[model samples]
Target: MTFDRKDKDNVTLLNFYLQLLYPRMVEEKMLILLRQGRIGKWFSGIGQEAIAVGSTMAMKSEEYILPMHRNLGVFTSRNVPLTRLMAQWQGKLSGFTKGRDRSFHFGTQEHKIIGMISHLGPQMALADGIALGDLIASKEKATLVFTGEGATSEGDFHEAINVAAVWNLPVIFLIENNGYGLSTPVNEQYKCKNLVDRAIGYGIEGLQVDGNNILAVYDLIDSVATRMRENPRPVLIECLTFRMRGHEEASGTKYVPHELLEEWAKKDPILNFEQYLLEQDILTPDAVAEIKANLKMEIEQEVEAAFNEPEPLAKEEEELKDMYFPYTSDPVSPEGPVKELRYLDAISDGLRIAMQKHTNLVLMGQDIAEYGGAFKITEGFVQEFGKARVRNTPICESAIVGAGLGLSINGFKAVVEMQFADFVSCGFNQIVNNLAKTHYRWGEKADVVVRMPTGAGTGAGPFHSQSNEAWFTKTPGLKVVYPAFPADAKGLLLAAIEDPNPVMYFEHKYLYRSLTGPVPEGFYTMEIGKANVLRQGQQLCIITYGLGVHWALDYLDENPDISATLVDLRSLQPWDKETVSAAVKNTGRALILHEDTLSCGFGAELAAWISEHCFKYLDAPVMRCASSDTAIPMNKALEDGFLAKSRLKHTLNQLLAY
Candidate 1:
């Protein structure tokens, strides 16, 4: 590789020199910290500093930057203070995340930079959402996202890139092809001639650059930045570089040939940049030495100060505040007699009322724009809210949810609709791993709601009709809510919009029109994590939610002889344990029911809890009734038999007989 001899002024030359020195100084100090047992682990960007520094330097100050763990140069270039970085690595309270997470896993609203999670591929998809939100607002800004060659193998990588392409989001996908994914070589990870070539299929521009040449990398990105800002198009730029160090401190490169490592070390990004500056007479030899010495001193002082700071104390009560949804109530409620409304109409009214009240609320889903969603729940929403707020996304479930997460982090609450509740499996990675873990991992707020159209009655078959609430209930860091009435449905949807955490709001498809009742006309919020007692009784307790709530109510109404207290467990995760336990202890018997499958369902957890806590109070074994352990068939007869009302009636009769 050769350098282009051109003077782009003193400011540019000076910044290039500093970028080269910053990462080199930090990585060397990181090795010392590891030896002293001050930091736990380190992933050095040693030979690839140029790619991080060069690409980021081209971005505007306000443009969002999403970087993976290895991009140390990008962090420093973005003006992330050395003290905060040092404190974070040392696990001190003065760190960015207040010691919630260790190293590079922290973000701040002020900097407009989202700290990278361990999942490298998903961040690319998230960047698309952030960029999409900006595009919707007509903001002239671009998003810069970084990943490695190995991450391209992940499903999220393709999903995000495809969405960006289809939507023409102003996002720059920078792939740092560092030759290897930990111990595995590039050949084993991808079969393409070059990673950038894959952009041909995405209908985006592609380019490959010599990542070791800082000047060339900067020039290529700088030329495209202005164009991307104007047109807002997704572009792929592949930087060919190598990680001179092992994956982490302890992970030795035994799999890499010694000759290969030696060859790459000779072309180190920082060392090459330094030589270029010297040969071009941009700086004298003494000036180069002085810059390195000053950077080292600054880094050492930062480490010393950060190590002296006190570590953050974890208060159980205070920390628990961030664990679940904070307590809040609705201000707008009906003063006069409430009007009767259909359950589906109530949901639409709730969305309209919330959108009118809160400016930060936005809705995204497939066919949600002109089509108003699959069931017309959002009919005419586009005309009322405009295309910007009411977005029709591509058929990418993972991208839809992942982008919603990005919007949440950026101070906007996203109401994401899964076309079918069962289709959420396509974006399972974002739902369970990313959305559920963001708050717990770094104490960052994920204020987003995933609206699931769940349950069966329309004979939509296995793929469309499924009660997947059990899947989310089993995962931590999520609030699951299922409303059986129009009033609760409207109130809870409003409450979820105002929540500061992620919520899984399951709207049963069957109850959308069949179950109608008097609903408040104005904005109101039902308290989350509480159960509603529909009917009080002394014979037994029926713990149910969603469609099961209706079944339990219908059975008791018809069989007037059996008297039982029906508890609607609206909140499945942090369920109203106090209410259910008290009701069960009073009745001396319990029957847990749900629309989900019988085996390994959420009801199993409830049954176990009742047995453990209300054990002595039990008059008979705590029984659980749910849909048969089979896929919901397309035939109405088969589906009804699968979750038959008669079967539920028989289960209640048997429990009453016991």
Candidate 2:
């Protein structure tokens, strides 16, 4: 099956032709199905079959191939059952995503194919993650990822390429320059003469090939991949091709010039390759006709079989089942001796302990290696564990987060640290769209823990200081953990890393050095979704988390006769509802407090829930005290005034009096 010219015979060439022909015919049948309302939509790759077929066939089966919507040949070349593919396109139960996603949006773990998200550039970074796994495992395998010329304009493209170049990961970034991105031409896409030229800027090798020529693609990819297995490094390859069809069947090609269509139609990949096969006597005219007939018949039968397949049943339990992997909370034993540590030290120790426990755990972030991160959390980590385990990524938040998802796909627990919580905005799409939606979309576990250094009491300004926990708490498949004490910080972090779902561990920057407590010496895991009752009282309940817990404790310490119960919610996403409700009912009054802004904060949800469930037991209305709906100020006095702590005593006294 190797593409060696000296070993090439009629059989090899015929097999190549069959590989190319199957997708072309599938595209043809799929179009008819789309027109006949059999399927939802189509992203036709009519004129660019050679790129997908040749590049995919060039790699080994164990090496992963990440393909976009137009790269259907990647699936077909891997011999994915046509019936299942058709069922996928038709949104049937037998599809890879079980009707959760349509078209080539689903990936098959068995085939070692990672599918693309709609944001085309993220998958490129995802490939870097898989290649990183290969590099770490010392596996001689190269990961091939496909992108369009249009996606090259995305920041993720540059970020992924730059990271791969720096790490020397075995990844082949294949850009199929199909003349147009949807309707925008190459002129609008970039200023470079060729897409491959950008590789020089990244300090990586670049190559260009006629995408229509199947042999050229096969030869170049095979040689590059072979070299990469020995000396692992990324290479950029731009395959010059044209899109014969519109972006999708719904979008007509009227925007395209007729002359251009005619020109590309003459150089159709299938026809040109067929002619080459005919001239070489590898495929006679009768053989070509017979191959097409058989492929068309096979495709039609598969499509018909797909039509007979059952549609996904609208069952509530089944629909909700795969949102997250099954998890049980392990009791915190704290088996060994304990030692006092700061919040920062507890986080450091927790990560250190997790790294020791899970050999496959990887830490990725900016300035985390030699510099020990912005907060000095991972100061000596690179020295303890090598650079491979403690990776210092570029300031490409989007790409690095996507890489975490990639690493998780290959059975690695990834802990991605956001230097500051506010910086997460840069990688929002990867977090919410890719990581959070992964398990729900295809039942794939994303064992990634994103450490967000959050909160603002030291005048770090609006950008550096933000308690944005509510942003991800609303996201379905993500877990949000925010601990106030040092011990809880370490325990919750350990639990977050072990969780099967993507967990957002928000570490309060204000608490890093200011807070200290007795943290267990050895490894231990605290139960997520549980609240800690720091104090018990009968008059009122103070519900809070992170720095707010400190604020509540300070208020309670000064006012001894207040008789208020303090509840610190360790996890926000699955906040301890039972404990909060019970405390509120017991006290007959409630006050929700947080460091985040007042409007639409996590406090709002807590207030609403308390009102709904604890209405009968309430002695007073549920009150919320939070920061003003404005950006965190830089001046110390203004910041103190802006925070909820400024008015916490007054608010608590008012609630107690009520």
Candidate 3:
């Protein structure tokens, strides 16, 4: 693995020459496939081989890589079979994602290379989490992540590097500055002389190298790898190269100036490396020709074999329901010693119990370690579980979510906390795009729990106080749960932690202390996507979740005249539609309520469902009562007006009258 001066130049030449051949051959074959209409679209990394090949060669075998679309060289150099790569391009079942994805969006768990999504920036942030996990576990291997110049323009780039720098994570931000962000030129991307200079802002070492020179890249990486083995600091490396072809085959070279293409063609990495081997007397003309011929034949054979491989069989709609979510069944209610605990205490207890039972569970959040989180939910966790398990991260929401995905990929369940549910927007892409879709796309479960401290009863203004569960409820391939009672908080969270898919656990901020109840003592998990009946009546059905359930209960308690059944929808995404429907039909009237703004809240969906399914059974139209469509104000009066329990009472009275 050592590429030192002691090694013969001929040895290095042969190694580099072969590394360059695979991607170039693949690129050529992809172009052929594109013409024949065998593949959907093709992205050629024709000139950018040196960066992936050299850097991968310098790293250890066990190290993980989060590659972008233009990193076929990385896949090739890291021993990914050519047949599998070709099969992936053809969207066959033999592919890593089993025809779930096309193009470069496929990777295998065995290889430790996560499949790249179209959003290039989140993977870079994800690499930070992978590196952090290894670091905490005291692993020596470092993570190398590839990103383009355009991706650096994203906030994820800054958030990722900032976390790496602050935490001294063992991750390398390898920026392939290929002189353009797709059609846009590098001149318009940023004003900085070199992309590496931006690394100084994050207080990390920055280096720019001739990306065409494999030896230079290898040496710099080798040195950095040695230093990082001891120091564990992030490094920003800008590989100055050019995209020899159009962005993709269909994109064409039309937008690219003829002069620029002509200039870059002369500096082609593979051709240049081949010439260097010949000039150094390391490879004869016949040897070079033979190698090229052998590679061409091998690639052609693999591509042909991949084409013959059967495509993935189409799954039935019912069978595909739990492909991403397996645990759709009801929960087994707990029967054990009961402890009267606050909702927050119950949550902490759940975490403590889960971690104590499962060694693989790790808790991460901003100010969660010593500061014990913003709401002190994890006040004593760091001392009990140690800092490595109860990790304190930088204020990067995206990185936290992205890192959780990485951890889940590596066989660890991460319990990541968002300071406030409203702040989840910062990591929205990672949550909705990466984490939510991973299971559905590749049958890869992202076993992560996002503990959201949500709801608007607190006067923490628009940023800190908000109910955003409805946002994730609309998303596919995600488990959304909002526990009302302390027992449900403890039980549902325990279930979420053990679940194979990504679960969004929304803990109402107001309910943390106010909604105290007798929580079970031992570890138990309530069924997800199931509703609980707090009180049963016949005249009307009030269906609600989170704090809304309590508001509905209060209205009935004070009135005593309202004969309404109270149903708490603990799980929103895969809601208890059957249970709620039965209750609505039995009562002959339905009311959906929540704390999120009324316009597009979970109430809308519930109301729609009741109206459609129980139209004939109902005595009156399905009605909804939720906060007004406006930001929660800091003033107590305005905040109360925005989400007052009296509103629920008035709305229920009108529904009864109707």
Candidate 4:
């Protein structure tokens, strides 16, 4: 159906006088700042204030709004103070981000406005996450995600919208089709006449509105917001308007036709709205002038205060650093707690206890809440902790994991679960960019735990079964851990939760049900980078971790004549090289074993380390025993036949032979 209704005099203005005049004056002030060199650059919401103001006005307080960078009008209208915003552009500590974010990266968390992701479409995913949060929290509020038509072409936008549609999330996607995405025209970017029609592919309805008319934008978006609360679905709305300014400063906008530019110049949003108000008799020229005068005075004062305000100070920076790190370090714990508990229970109880101890700690994965996770490791948390603390997230791995880093950086201790380790590739970006590098780049820690059910042997086949610890152990600043029994699981998890860095804490799915061991009921601690000397002997040092420790210890027990020191490298990075080095130095002979494939496995690295540092002390060349680089077969016997366990058995016999 053709939605060609364009009612010029129909736009409504409902801002408290302070809020109303503030936006127009701020936009003008920004223009002045750009000319005065007080700010870096400016992107004005000059001709689009109607859409920005009205749509934001239509939203509920609890409802989320993910505004595009151009929504300066909406920001001002919704209580994003002008002085702080000016400081944001000025790169001052008085900025809304306290001097961290970019100039346009404005946010008003108190107003339920999530910060925008500037690369265009990342905010789509964030908006979906906000909706997911609403659903999980059982809040009736919906999410309003704003973007330009240019963002519609981004792959992430499609991915986010598709997922939202499939899940029937309470989300409204608003596209400010302001004729251009900088130099590129909206029509040039996509073949479609309307950006909203793209939602049809994802099984969601689309609507188009005359963005120049504020009432059209307001009433349409408001109805969509209401529909979301009632039916809980994702919808896309295209707002057709013209952008009056160059994309960011006065640069690279030479592409628009002179005729079109002149035509748009005649239809400026504020002036047209003023004329419409005059015609409706709702406002007079004198009243408008008075409003502008009051706004100008208020803005002048706020901007002066913002510019004159002192820096956030060392203490505030220190506090922001802590906000970015959910976990608290324990003076590098004096003792590793491996001796006190079993493996599986170690991780489960460690996480449980950490959640109890840290109010900011939140957990999520498939069936993790009520089911205590698929392994029953987190089984009782829902009852004891409530869904808010221990929640079951939808099976959207990428979206779920991506938010973990963002949430953790924003003061929540997030533990995102990839139900099976093999499926981690689905959320690889979250693990790599969001978690590992975010800390090292900005000198801020993203204290998030990515828990995955790893390893094999339940006949789950290649898809469900994997021992891929080696792949991630290679990444710097990402602490990796795997536990064999209940105690180590709990201990290592406790250490992981408290680490001021990202941790890839993997639990063996096979061992979760059967690997129970005694864990003390009381809360305890463990050192993250230290490994335990499970069994010490004089002949050789066998460095291993995860369930491999179990088989090695058992083998040593049976053959006391084959004396060896077993070291569990609990933390993969900053691994207890001291412990391993000492054991190798004393024993003279060394061997490294693991469950992952032979090629470049963690065992290979250990062997390389021994060869480099302990070559002189070695009784023989360092050896590595690992599984073949083939998919774990469905047949149990064949899988075991191809495993590192058999090679480990052979190595033991050979060491004895020597």
Model 4 gets an lDDT of: 0.73
| Highest TM-score scorer | 2
RMSD of 1: 2.2
TM-score of each: 0.94, 0.98, 0.95, 0.72
Q: Highest lDDT, which number? A: 2
lDDT (CA) for every model shown? 0.86, 0.91, 0.85, 0.73
In candidate 4, what are the lDDT values of residues 32-69, reduced to their tens digit? 87788877777777777767777887898656677887
lDDT string for model 2 (429-545, tens) is 999999888877777888999999999988989999998999999998889999899999999999999897899999998888988899889988899999999999999999999
Instruction: Order the numbered candidates by TM-score, best leading.
Output: 2, 3, 1, 4
Q: Candidate 3 lDDT, tens digit per residue, 1-658?
A: 1123436467766987798787888888788778888777888788888888988888887888888888887888888998988777777878877777787675577777776899888898788888887887788868889899998999999999998898798998899989877799988888888899999899999999888777778888878887887889999999988887778877877778889888888877777767766676888899978988998999898889998887777877843674475665556567778989999999989999999998878898989999999989999888888988898888889998998988887767899999988889999999999888887777678899999999887788989988888889888888899999999999999999989788999999998878789988987888888899888898899898888888887778888987888999899978998999889888998888888888988888888888888899999988888888998898888999998464887787788889
Query: Among all windows of ten consecutive residues in candidate 4, which has the lowest summed lDDT?
Result: 1-10
Q: What's the distance in Å from true for residue 55, model 4?
A: 2.2
- TM accuracy, model 1: 0.94
- Candidate 2: misplaced stretches above 4 Å? 1-7
